[model samples]
Target: MDIQLLTRKIPIGISQCALGEPVRYNGGHKHSKVCTQLLGRCFDYVPLCPEVAIGLGVPRQPIRLVKSSPAADAEVRVIGVEDKNLDVTEPLMEYADSVVPALEQVRGYIFMQNSPSCGLRGVRRYLPNDHGIDSEGVGIFAQRLREHFPHLPMEEVGRLNNSEIRENFLTRVFAYDAWFRYVEDGQDAPRAGRVIEFYSAYKYLLLAHHQQKTRELGQLVSNARALEPREFAHQVRGGIMEILAHPASRKDRTNALMHVQGHLKDYLDKEETAELTRLIEEYRLGLKPVSAVLTLLRHYLPRSPHQFIHSQLLLAAEPAEMGFCDFH
Candidate 1:
C-alpha cells in the first residue's frame, strides 16, 4: 500500500459560507472548521454562495421557502422574509441550473445546515399565510443540485458531526473519484476485464456496507458482457453509490474485518493473530474506532503483498481524512 498512490485530492463542491467566506445574509461566515481545517486537506473545494451568486449583498434580507399551494406541482418560492413581495426563487434556481454543468466534475458536496439555500435536508418551508413552517422542505439550491447529480455524495456540515455519516461521505467521495479517474484515463471501450478488477478491489468494502447489495453488484459486473462499456461503467458507479448510501453497521464491519483477517491468517504468528483478534473484538465492543483496527491491518498489508488485498480501498481509504473522526 504505497500512500502516494492514494494521495490525490478530489474536487468537492461546498457552500461558500462553510469555507469561512463572508457570504451569509447576516454578513458573517458559518465557518465550519471540519470542512476548512480537515476535509480541506484532501479536497479541492468549489465554493458557491447561492444568495451571493444571485447578486444578493452582504447584510441582505433573509429568505425563506414559501409554498404557494398544497399540490405537489405547486410553486415554491425563495422569498425575502422581511419583504414577502421580494421573490428571488427564479434567480436562485437559475443560478443553481447555471452552475450544475460545472459541478459535474465534483465528487461530493458539503452544504451548510439550516440554510434556505444550501441545507441538504430539514430546511424550513413556510406557508404563504405565514402561519406554520414545514420541516420537510429541501433548500432550493440543494434541491436542484440533487436533481442534477442524484448519485453524488452530499451532506450537511451538521449531520457530518455523526461519525458514521462522516465516514460514509468520505468513502463515497473517494470511491467516486477513483471511478471517475479510471474511466477518464482509460480507453474509449474499457475492457470488461478491467471493470471486473475494479469491482474486485471494492468487494470487501461493498460487503461491509451490505452483503446482498455486494452480491448483486458482483452479478452486475459479471454480466458486463450483456452491456456496452459506458453502460456497464454507469451501472457499476450507480451500484457502488447505492450500496454505500447505507451506513455500515458494526456487525457488518466486523464480518468484513474477519474476512480480511482470514486472508492473512497464515502469515501472522499466534501472538500476532491473538493481538489482531483483540483489536477486532475491541472494535466490535465499540471500545475502539474502526481506524484502530484498520491501522493494524494496514501494518500487515505489505507483509503478505497480495494484489487483491493491496488494491482494496477498504484498507487504504482516506487515512488522512480519518482525522475528521475526531472532530464534530
Candidate 2:
C-alpha cells in the first residue's frame, strides 16, 4: 500500500482555544483531543482566536449584548453598555471584520461554543432595560465569518463530541477542500481529469450517501467538454454547491453500505456476508450508520488492496465532524 494514499490533507480553521491556545475569557483553553489527535494528522490546521484578534486581551472585561427586545427572544449581538453604562465595541467589530478577508485559505472553521465573542451557536445576549437575559447572542466574529463565506464548512468544537456531528463536519471539510483545489484555487480552467478522477472514486460513495445532486454533479462535469470554459465554469461551481447542500444522511449512508455489501458478495464467506448485511439493515433502522458501515468495511477491506484503498478514499473524503473516527 502506498503510504501517501493513506494520508489526506485538509485545510481547516479552528478557534485558538480549541487548539490549546489560552485565548478564552478567563485566560484558559477548551482543548479538543479529537482535533489535536485524531483529526490533526489528516488536516493541516489554521488556528485563530477572533476575540484575541479583536483586541480583547486575555481576562478582559466580559462583554454582552443588551438586545433590542426586552423578551430576549431575538438573535443576539454584542453591546458595550450595561445598566446604562458606557459602550466599547467599534474596535472589536472593526478587527473582526478585517480578519475575515484573510480567511480565504480556510475550507472550514471550528469555533468555540457559547462564547459571547466567538460562539458559533447560541451565545447569550442581555436586555439592557433589565429584561433579564444574556445568553442568546451570536459571537461577533463568528457571525461575520458566516456572513462573509457562507459556502465554507464550519462547526463548533463542542459539536464534535457527537460522533455523527463529527463525521458530517469532516465529510464536508474534505469535500470542500477538494472542491477548492479542483475548481476554485487559482487555475483559470477546470482540470476535467482531476475532477473526474475524484468523482469516479467517489461515485458509489456519493450514491451511498444519498447525494443525488452529487451523482448529477458527476454527470455534469463529465458532460462539460462541449461547452466553452466561461459557460462550463458557472455550471460546475453551481453543481458542486448543490451536492454540498445535502450533507450525507443516515438513510443515504446505509444505502451506501448496502451497495458496498452487494459488491462484496464474491469475497466474504456466506456467514460473514450475512452478518454485515444485518448491520447494514440495522443502520437503515437508525442504529448509527457510521459504526455500522465501518464495522463491515473494516472486516472485509483488509483482505483486498483495491477495496482497502476505495474504503479509505470514501472515508477521508468525509467531513471529520461527521463521525467518530478518521476514516483516512
Please report the candidate that would top lDDT against the real structure. 1
TM-score of 2: 0.69
- Residue 77 shift from truth in candidate 2, angstroms: 3.7
Instruction: List the lowest-lDDT window of 10 residues for candidate 1.
Output: 319-328
Query: Which ten-residue region of model 2 has the weakest summed lDDT?
Result: 1-10
> Tens digit of lDDT per residue, candidate 2, span 46-147?
888766676668976666655766553654456544324534355556766777766788778888888766787777666756565655567777777777
Residues 216-311, candidate 1: write the lDDT tens digits. Answer: 998889888899887787788789889988888888888889989998998899999999999999999999988898989989988886788877
**Over 4 Å off, model 1:** 1-8, 71-74, 186-191, 266-278, 299-306, 321-328
lDDT of each: 0.82, 0.66
Give me the candidate number with maximum TM-score. 1
Once model 2 is optimally superposed onto the true structure by TM-score, how far is the C-alpha of residue 165 displaced, in angstroms? Answer: 1.6
TM-score of each: 0.86, 0.69
Q: Each candidate: RMSD to true structure?
A: 3.2, 5.5
